[model samples]
Target: MQTETLTLNGQPFYIRRWGDPALPPVLLLHGFPEYGGAWEPLARHLADRFHCIAPDQRGYGRSWAPEGVQNYAMSALVADMAALISHTGAPLTVIGHDWGAGVAYGLAMFRPELVARLIIANGVHPVPFQRALAAGGAQAEASQYINFLRRPDSHKILAANDFEKLLALFSAKMDLSWLSGELRAAYKAEWARDERLNTMIHWYRASPLQVPEPGQALTGLPDFPRDKLLVRCPHLLIWGQDDTALLPEATEGLEHYAPDLTRVTLPGVDHWLLHQTPAEVARRIKDWMP
Candidate 1:
């Protein structure tokens, strides 16, 4: 992979590229607590057929992570990616996992001209997600961690003892076989960087999505501009059925937004499937977009 820094909106955004620039581009967006390097496992499998470009998104890895909760707003996050897409040339396929999928859906909705296709793994769109989270059911209970991360002092706790708490948050009793050895050390190194723990968690604070106390509904969410939230491009949702954090109900009725949508479920896999079964994910992507 090749690395470079681009001055995006006056921020030094770092990017990793695999495969030839002349080939069709595929933008890979990673989620919170993980960097662009997180895409390496899957990118390696897709590089021969596609140009995989993964950037250390706003408050993660080597990207420009500014101070304050306002800086982490969804609009700002989407703008950062929009600039990258415009810089890289439009109509490229976008693949996102976790938080990355949020930005990918934003791009597909607001800037459809730039996205050839939309793909999400272990992620959900804001509308349905907001619905599920507000209803105060299983998904809301599963998402209590978001509220914890939003705490101003949560970073201090996570940073202690070589990020013991952060590791616990990451694992959450799921399969972490892919997180051991070299990759584990690499993630720790990124976490150890100055202000990373603090800035990365601010994303939780900036989001308007509400997670009520377990078993109680959170009402009166602000109006969502539903007309603009449609995903016009061909969309593919790859899910790990065993995912505990984001339950199926979170993305229930996703077809209403993404008219041309296809879904593939992987049994016994969880949120970290990108790392756990990247080659399988790669094969599915190739088969879809080939």
Candidate 2:
């Protein structure tokens, strides 16, 4: 694998690439508070047959952290992805987890031509997400962390203690034994490099629930075209059934948005399925893709 940096939409992004450049691309997007390197093990497994490109999304790891809460909005994030695809010069099979999964959905909605296939792990479709939040039942319970992240001082507090708490959060939720000590140290080093916690907190801070536009539907944006909405490309969804952050109920009707979707539920896996079951996850992804 090799690491490189490029500017996309005026924001600097750090990307890690594996396999031959001539092959069809598989672009992986990591979730919030995590970096592109998170996909290293999985990328290694897929590199024999696919070109894997994983970028540290804006405000995470070595990537540029732009100011202002608005910079972290879904639209802007999708633009960053578009810029990445344009830079790479290839039709891509996009895969995302958590917050990255949300960005993947936005890409399919806003720039379907760039994507040939889609894979999402542990996230709900945007339309249903909006409806669930408004319905205020299980979604509210699943999303309590959103409110916690929205607090004004949350970022400062999380960063103040040298990311001790943040590291603990990962250790508690995921099986960190898969990550070698060197890799874990590297992640901690990157987390300490910038005010990443504050920048990342802006994702939740700028979300629809916190700042709704007047007269806007609870969804907060125009519904994507229904005809175009169904991801026509081959799609795969692997979910960690025990995810507390995004309940299984949230994913109940995902097929409505992805009619071609193939889904797998991991019985005992949690939100950090990538780490908890990296080999299983990678094998499933490889088998799912053409």
Top model number, TM-score: 1
RMSD of each: 1.0, 3.7
Candidate 2 local lDDT, 1-290, one digit each (tens): 99999989887899999999887888999986778998887787788888999998988888888878988888888899899998987468999998898888888877888888999888667766766655566666556667767898877666666666666655664555665588767876776776776787787887775322323324445655677656677789999887766776677677787888899888788888887787888899888887
Per-candidate clash tally: 0, 0
Regions more than 4 Å wrong, model 2: 168-180, 209-229
lDDT, candidate 1, 181-210, per-residue tens: 888999988877778878888888999888
* TM-scores vs. true structure, each candidate: 0.98, 0.89
Model 1: residues >4 Å from true position, as ranges? none
lDDT of all predictions: 0.91, 0.78
In model 2, the Cα lDDT at residue 154 comes to: 79
Deviation in Å, model 1, residue 279 alpha carbon:
0.7
